[model samples]
Target: MHINPYGEDPVRFAVELAVDPPSSAADLVARCRAAGVTDVTGREVDLDDVRRFLDEWLGVVDAPDEAARADRLNALLAAASAYPRLTNHAGDGWHLHYRDPDLPLAGVLRALISVGTALHLAGRGMHRLGRCAVAECRRPFADVSRTGRQRYCSPACANRDAVRRHRARVS
Candidate 1:
């Protein structure tokens, strides 16, 4: 199956930022670059913009139901999306972009994350985005597993919960 390129990675990137926000503008830009973001010029407002966007995205993740999630995401999609365009920079294969050209780092992130998240939720299940089930660890997690049954943020959390249950049962 041809998985959508814009789906998984962008949601993962959003989760990473929401988990541990960048300490500085440089750190944010560096993280973006590490995530294969292109055309980042390191503008000062990028940090604030990205933080604001992440906050809004968290609202989507924390939505009470699928309809609410779709509402929040639709708002983001309306705010962030632009006309689609095709580009082939650096001789790479041409790809469609849903953002305008010459946008700043934050703008790029907003477009990518919003559109990618929409595609993910629409293609996958609407309940795919969620927080960890562990009581002490409410970290956000994107359900990327093939079966779409991810409840914890990581295997460690699942194991921890299992051990806790085992201990409770033994006692």
Candidate 2:
């Protein structure tokens, strides 16, 4: 569709989903709506499915190494029920859609998430995604930095980590 910086949006949405899953169907729909997921069905099952999807998706994000990463992601792709297709929705023009109607909620997510993650890594840089540098917070992130060297989840986290490191060095 519009591709509103597809590389960034999908990765960011994936990371966000991984960090804190939505509490309810409305919350899930709202979060997805904010992330450009148009036409959310506003159903409780969708939220539950997405929660499951995110937990599995986080495993993809947290895989220890590249090979492990591929293994986890490959499992998802293999299990996905939807075949890749080109379609457009809402006001967006033509783009890829890796799903078909009537797909189960989890299956739908497996397709969308797998395809989206593939596009994000291939189109963007493979190194664009990572975990936060803060030791206490293992949250994952998509590095959309212009310099391509972002190591922290947020400035606050960075600052706190820096202070911790400085204190450690001084001690």
Candidate 3:
């Protein structure tokens, strides 16, 4: 079966990029490729735009409450973006692409990330994406868990958190 390309990877890409944004278009593409971003568009100038866009995205994440979340996300959608379209890159059958052609890297990312995030958070659960529970690990994680109680980022973090709690109780 053809797994959805816009699944875990794109959401993870957003977290990775948001956590530590790349400095160049090549860097963006390279990092994305490393993170499992298959199909892509844009180059150097596009990368610069992507960096700027990420800064704005971070602000949304930092927003205080649900009202602010909607405001920030809506602001992001209203600014220099577009609706979803159909594409069939490499004749791989049609799928919805939420971007225009040849957009600079930032524009492409804004759509990909926004749409990918929407799909991920909605499909998975609103609480899916979040910071790891381990104190020192500030990494973001997209919870692909079958159960919705995923508070920590990974098994390591979950174990570490449980251990910390146990140690504190014993002490």
Candidate 4:
């Protein structure tokens, strides 16, 4: 079965890109492929534009409250607005795409990231996306945990914080 592309994957990808942005167009394309994005072609990619778009997206992640987050995300959604359409590009089977056909890799990523983030937040919870609880490593992360109480970006960060707390108690 064809999985929905505009779902958890894109949101997770956004987090990955935000944490360590691609250094070049080739790097971006390679990372996209690594993240299961098969549609990217060797078209001229503008890394600056993608970085700018990602900065805007990070605003939603860093918003002070739910309302602010929604507002920021709504702006991005509006910017990437396109009527949903079905296609079987690359013989991947029919799937819904919320973007215009033949768009550049940057355009496609903007739409996917925006729509995917919306779906993730609406389907999961507004508080699902956040920064790591570790003060030294405030990296962004998409909390896909079943219990939805994830505070750190990774198990290591969580364990590090816990160990610090334990040491403090002992001292």
Please tell me which predicted candidate would have the highest TM-score against the true structure.
Answer: 4
Minimum summed lDDT over a 10-residue window in model 1 is located at 37-46
Per-residue alpha-carbon lDDT of candidate 4 for residues 1-171, written as tens digits (9 for 90 to 100) = 788888699999999999999999999999999998888875568899899999999999999999999999999999885999988987958888999888888888999999999999999999999999999999999999999899999999999999999999999
User: Which candidate order results from sorting by lDDT in descending order?
Assistant: 4, 1, 2, 3
TM-score per prediction, in order, is: 0.93, 0.82, 0.79, 0.97
The segments of candidate 1 whose C-alpha lies over 4 angstroms from its true place after superposition are 1-5, 42-45
Please list the C-alpha lDDT of all candidates, in the order they appear. 0.88, 0.71, 0.69, 0.92
Query: Candidate 4, residue 94: CA error in Å?
Result: 0.8
Ranking by TM-score: 4, 1, 2, 3
Off by over 4 Å in 2: 4-6, 42-44, 89-92, 104-106
TM-score of 1: 0.93
Considering summed lDDT, which 10 consecutive residues are worst modelled in model 4? 36-45
Give the lDDT of residue 14 in candidate 3.
78
| Tens digit per residue, CA lDDT, model 1, 43-117 | 444688889999999999999999999999999999998988877653567788888877787888899999999
Clashing pairs in 2: none
Q: Write the per-residue lDDT of candidate 3 for residues 41-149, one digit (tens) a residue.
A: 4343566567777777666555666466557767876774577677776476877766776766566678777766666766776666666768698576767789967
Task: Provide the lDDT at 132 for model 1.
Answer: 97
Give the range where candidate 3 is weakest over 10 consecutive residues by summed lDDT: 36-45
Would you list the clashing residue pairs of candidate 3?
46-105, 50-106
Colliding residue pairs in candidate 1: none
